[model samples]
Target: MSFRNFTTGQSHGFGGTYLKLVPGEMLVYSDVFDDPNLPGEMTVTVRLTAVSVGTEMTVVQENVPDVIPVEACYLGWQDSLRKLAGLVEPEITG
Candidate 1:
């Protein structure tokens, strides 16, 4: 098992998009395995807690094995965003 802290955000109309991952909490780092009968991709889950607001977000990343080449790693990123969106809440700031 491994952990990583990844944060990403996007705003409409020139607000800009931010995406970054600090590898301080890497939970799993193993050498690439090459086997004839093994899974193609590995799923990684990471949970981050906001220091100031006590908010939590879960980030899921899929490590696509080079052995099994696919189209693109799109679904994995989308799953991460969907998990974070579930924990979003509105706050009053003045």
Candidate 2:
């Protein structure tokens, strides 16, 4: 089994972005406006892997998406959020 974490964020004034973090010292996605005037919100996602070595478990591999669509306006916030979530959580498990 694999563990996954998904996140989403939004802002009204400037813009929005997305990020994802995973195991094995991997960074899913990251981006910055560099301009203070580009105020916005961002979301982060994380995934953890487990490895067994001599009765010890550790992270093996991870996959992180890219942080893009740095729109300066909150236009496709909802649709984008849902799309991101879908990518993060393709299936539901109990």
Candidate 3:
């Protein structure tokens, strides 16, 4: 799926297909980011492990673009995951 960046009005987000998925277990996908400065593609892997109290979700984004700083991406992902966890975890907990 293609995503647009509202801030920059750029279609610099992911546009790809879902490679694999196993409910409550794992997911894999590929995406292309058409960054005007650093266009590239990547594979994203999400793994979920069940714990006694909750599920542990891990995200691995591979094949990063050289123009994009890994540290900035990491921080962005952290914020995204935090928001996602807030949205998803409560449903599972309830």
Candidate 4:
């Protein structure tokens, strides 16, 4: 699926198909952001582990453009995680 602005619902011009999926355990995919700020495709791998109390998640992004600052990706992923948690954690506990 393509990435879109949450507010505008417009395509961000970056899109890719899923490379691998394993139910709740793992997801790996290609994401290409064809913007002036970001000009490359990166492989994203998200792995999940079940814990006694909850779940553990790890996200690894590779082949990111050297021109892109790491801090930008950090902030972007942090925001995404917050949004994701809001969507999933409630159902896990509620």
Clashing pairs in 2: 21-45
lDDT for model 4 comes to 0.83
Task: Name the runs in model 3 displaced over 4 angstroms.
Answer: 1-11, 86-94
lDDT tens string, model 3, 9-79?
Answer: 86654578899999989999987865556566788999999999988878898987887688967887887
**Tens digit of lDDT per residue, candidate 1, span 1-60?**
222334535221111112344564334322223343434435555556666866465655
lDDT of 2 by residue, 1-94 (tens): 1112234344323223435444454444333344455333333333444446422222221221224343412334445557887888669589
Off by over 4 Å in 1: 1-63, 67-72, 91-94
Residue-level lDDT tens digits of model 4 in 1-94: 4566567675556777699999999999998876767777889999999999988989898988897679968887898889887987756454
Q: How far off is residue 65 in model 2, in Å?
A: 29
Ranking of candidates on TM-score, top first: 3, 4, 1, 2
Candidates ranked by lDDT: 4, 3, 1, 2
Provide the clashing-pair count of each candidate structure: 3, 1, 0, 0
List the pairs of residues colliding in candidate 1.
Answer: 2-27, 2-28, 3-27
lDDT of each: 0.46, 0.38, 0.79, 0.83
Can you tell me which runs of candidate 4 are displaced by over 4 Å? Answer: 1-12, 88-94
